[model samples]
Target: MSNIVKKFKVENGKGFKLGDFDPAYSDGFKKIEARKTLKDLIDETFDLQTELYAANKYALLIIFQAMDAAGKDSAIEHTLSGLNPQGCQVYSFKQPSTEDYEHDFLWRHYRSLPERGRIGIHNRSHYENVLVTKVHPDLLLKEHLPGINDVKDIDGKFWDKRYESIRAFEKHLTDNGTVIIKFYLNVSKQEQKLRFLKRIDNPKKNWKFSAADIEERKKWADYMDAYEKAIKETATNDCPWYVIPADKKWFTRIAISSVILDTLKGLKLKYPVLEKEEKDKLDESKKQLEKE
Candidate 1:
């Protein structure tokens, strides 16, 4: 296990201040140096994932949460680039549809759980229900939970239940052979603004920029508070939240890849062993073919 990865993990996310984590902090690696390290990590990941798939006994679920333009998309693209597509799946959760609103908050995410022997990556996950909805409480009205009302008077207890629900949900996954590793891409507000500007300046990035993203930026402080509390409530041993610094794109990729490699290694995954009977059957078939 890498000691540096522990620096970024929130064992107890309680009192985690988004401001305390330096988004621009890097381990002094230039792009050239970082990519070399990253390549090695990716190779390790490919071999590990191959074993994970063949073992067919465990599943890995990776979730990413971040502020807009915090590089979630690119991070996913780069870190998991070496995986076999057949053994991996990526699901990007956007706003819910009319039908999605009809079910409980976790229903949609439950449907997306990775099958055994595969890796599932969620771009933005069910945590949004607690983070984004907590920031904009009024948005909760749209889903219309039984006790909620027009008064907009939800108390802390209301949030307590939601957090409890999230914890229990993850615990169930872990008990059932599913492993969860979550990442929160923590980008500084100043870095975010600069990136937003670059998006506006670059013609190719224009489509990524939107009026809604600007509006979301206006509520950055509230979002930070929401993320802090949500992470504090739900981070657990089976499902830890890694707060990755996002200002240095290259470093962020390497850190994420390293953490993922360490987790997979800890699982001690191996290809399944064939029974003696199975081995004898193979030998018999080979001998019969030779005789023919």
Candidate 2:
């Protein structure tokens, strides 16, 4: 892996701290240069994606988790622009429905998995269960989980179990054919405030602003603690987490594309080779088409 992208990977998240990363990091690449670099990365990823689909042996699941105003949407849009929509599936998870609450937290996400030879993108994925719910433990009541009927039931042991479940779930996916790549867009609180103000200031971006966003922002420290603990618990070699610098949208997109390209390259994907009989059949079909 290139050193440029390797620093962001958290294969073993021991002592991982969000404070250690700089959200404004650009690695000396200016916006103008980053655009071209991102384009090249996307082009290569697109080619590999085609081979991944044709080979039909693996499924890539990309999960994005971040604070509001962290530029997750734009990063995904720019980084994956070259992919064929037919071979990609993107899902954004928000509030749970009545049916969703009835099943385990991973249930809905499990159903959304891409078939072999496709890339599945989760805008805000299962990690939210640990993140938002951890911040607001009262939300757990909605799940109707057995035990106590109050937030007091959610002790440290409960959180440990939840983290264990996440680790095992990801392990099972990797044991099969699913390749999981988790990304945490690490935007600074100061940067988030600037973005919030920009959204409020710009008429075009006003719709993106919400009162609840402010409410959530109030619990920033709690969210950070939750994220830090969750990442430290679940990050592993098979399904590593990439804590990307997201203060600058251009740099965020570039860094994300680099990580994606590296992951796809490691897969060593190639178009399936035809057997002798298949080659003969193709030659015969070619001859018939030519005659026609």
Best of the candidates, TM-score:
2
Alpha-carbon error at 262 in model 2, in Å?
0.5
Span of 10 residues, lowest total lDDT, candidate 2: 1-10
Candidate 1 structure quality by residue, lDDT tens digits, 1-292: 3765887888676677667888887866678798788889999899999999999989999999999999999999999988788999999999898899999999999999999999999999999999888878888888888888963668888999999999999999999999999999999999999999999999999999998988999999899989889888988777888999999899999989989999899999988888999999999999999999
> Model 1 lDDT vs. the true structure?
0.90
Clashes of each: 0, 0
Q: Alpha carbon lDDT of residue 228, candidate 1? A: 88
lDDT of each: 0.90, 0.92
Worst 10 residues of 1 by lDDT: 11-20
Q: What are the runs in model 2 whose C-alpha is more than 4 Å off?
A: none
Residues 97-214, candidate 2, lDDT per residue (tens digit)? 9999999999999999989999999999999999999999999999999894999888999998999999999999989999999999999999999999999999999999999999
